[model samples]
Target: MTATSSPLFRPLQLGPLNLPSRIVMAPMTRARSSQPGDVPNALMAQYYAQRASAGLIVTEASQVSRQGQGYSFTPGIYSDAQVEGWRRVTEAVHAEGGRIVLQLWHVGRMSHASFHADGLPVAPSAIAPQAQVWVAGDDGVGRMVDSPVPRALSVPDIAAVVGDFRRAAANAMRAGFDGVEIHGANGYLIDQFLRTTSNQRTDAYTGATLEGRTRFALEVAAAVASEAGAERTGMRLAPFITQRGMDCPEIIPTILHLARQLDATGLAYLHLVEADWADAPQIPESFRAALRQAYQGRLIVAGGYDATRASQVLSDGFADLVAFGRPFIANPDLPRRLAHGLPLAAFDPKALFGGAAQGYSDYAPYEAVAEATA
Candidate 1:
């Protein structure tokens, strides 16, 4: 079949943006942001502009505040410099006729003490994710370190973080992004609050009841949607991810409940991050159907999808878009390559994180590689 005829090439109207294709560039942390302030830079802008063929580009998760940060070089949206830095990114993508959104993030317990002033991460409960985050030393060498137990957030603290999300959304608009995506997945702060394994709070946002567990996520979503306009806001969720101490049996139902609430609030899209590791538990097709029924808005699914699986998911009538993470790293023109059934270039594992433009932006398009080979 021709690339144009494939389901992956289908055009989609998500919120106020009209995407040219269903192929989305998923958010991935490359840890290359400018240091000292964790600001987005011209290099980051160039990196994104290289992949402008995507129907949608969700920028790497940018922390909403210093307290939300979990990694060394990841960018933030709270400061004026960070906003201006992101402006360059938005302008570059827009100049290339691409639509982009900033993923508003708060790592919660998925963080290290080095990223915080108090030398402790904060979460819904005082639990450790038992996971490791990439932390870079003064020499700029990054190594994975074990996560320390975090302090439980007070009710007032939860409200403060919600305001951070709200401010991040507004800053995304000022930066000229088409929208903002709440990073509610991958055992992050919002995900921590939704899971039984992480959240042991006794407050209103406790994990004891479905409503209590879901309140923090819902409130953050509401605040972001209110600031960015419900039509221009999307959120990501990962009910199948069990890593980072997020193995909650009740997560499936919890996410379903949240999906219904998100749908009711008129958010633009819901991105699902399925577990991508080999031997990881497969997300049941039954749950996919349930999510489709629960959320009426556009759906985007990421994790280990090639062209065929992506097309199949779209044809199955559940997902409106498919997000590619690692594939886009080496193939800037990934949509064209997928459409034409071209070979994909493998990315360098060594330079995957905490690097300059070598693995980040030095990748050539398939045509360029072909011409060079000739």
Candidate 2:
């Protein structure tokens, strides 16, 4: 592709914000936060500001409430300190000419009992998965612990969860975020309600129908849209990922149904998290075509996309934007490197999560590398 016609470099309008490129920095969980409050700090601000060249940046998944937390050291948006801490991050990114949104997250059944005061996590049903959640001890060390069976959320409890999401979105706005992305994927609370294996209730939430199963996601989206305008609201969905005993066959139709509902609600975008692992299941062209017919808003597809693959999808006219996860983790100037065919710096897995500057904000840019080598 010629420089003038390169799809990745083209500008696009996403809600009230206009982006300079089609490459979005996907949100990844890097558990480097203040220990006591799980708060965003100046180091996190430096990490985000380093990647300001992307079309947009979505911050890491943040818990809406104390009960929503699943991993140790992950930040939260519900508290006053968190809001103040996030304000520094937003300011840093804006000073670097970047647009950023916060992702609101709730782990639900994926959470461990240690996070809850009553020693029980809540979900759409009382079933437990064979998954593990990260928890921290008094020494501030994170360890993977088995997830226990969760208590079925009462109808009132479900309403309260929805309220938590709404309040989180409002808090995100107050924290100076451009918008909020509802975390409805990765076998979380909303995904638990969406899948049959995780959710086996006989109530309206999990009956023998798709509408009943999808009610929780739609309600959460509506509540978030109510707090943050629908135009500024986005959601991430993984229709193909089948982890934590969530490989349900009925998820395709249910996703289509939710897509149509989100379309009618005027949602800004739908970020689809395709499988990132090697030899992962391929999402058929038929499903992509069907999704296009179902949803009328912008579509962002993530998971293991390089420059050539991103160009192919954008050239095919199915995806509007492409999100790069781990690449952005190491290569802060990812869009520039893709545009110029520069060599990428490999990231060390040891410093991926819950670490200091070694693997977090200390990755030097390409210019520094060339200077040091010269």
Q: Highest lDDT: give the candidate number.
A: 1
Candidate 1: the clashing residue pairs are none
| Candidate 2 residue-wise lDDT at 156 | 93
Candidate 1, residue 39: Cα displacement in angstroms equals 0.8
By summed lDDT, the worst window of 10 consecutive residues in model 2 runs over 1-10
- TM-score for candidate 1, please give it: 0.99
* Runs of candidate 1 exceeding 4 Å displacement: none
lDDT of model 2, residue 4:
58
**Per-residue lDDT of 246-339 in model 2, one digit per residue for the tens?**
8988889889988998999999999999998998998888999999999989999998998989998998888999999999877889888889
lDDT per residue for candidate 1 within 1-374, as digits (tens), equals: 67877889978899889998999999999888887799999999999999999999999999999999998899999999999999999999999999999999999988998987889999998999999999998888999998899999988888999999999999999999999999999999999999999988887887999999999989999999888999999999999998888899999999999999999999999999999999988878899999999999999999999999999889988799999999999999999999999999999999888888998999999989999999
Assess every candidate by TM-score.
0.99, 0.98
What is the clash count of model 1? 0
lDDT per prediction? 0.93, 0.91
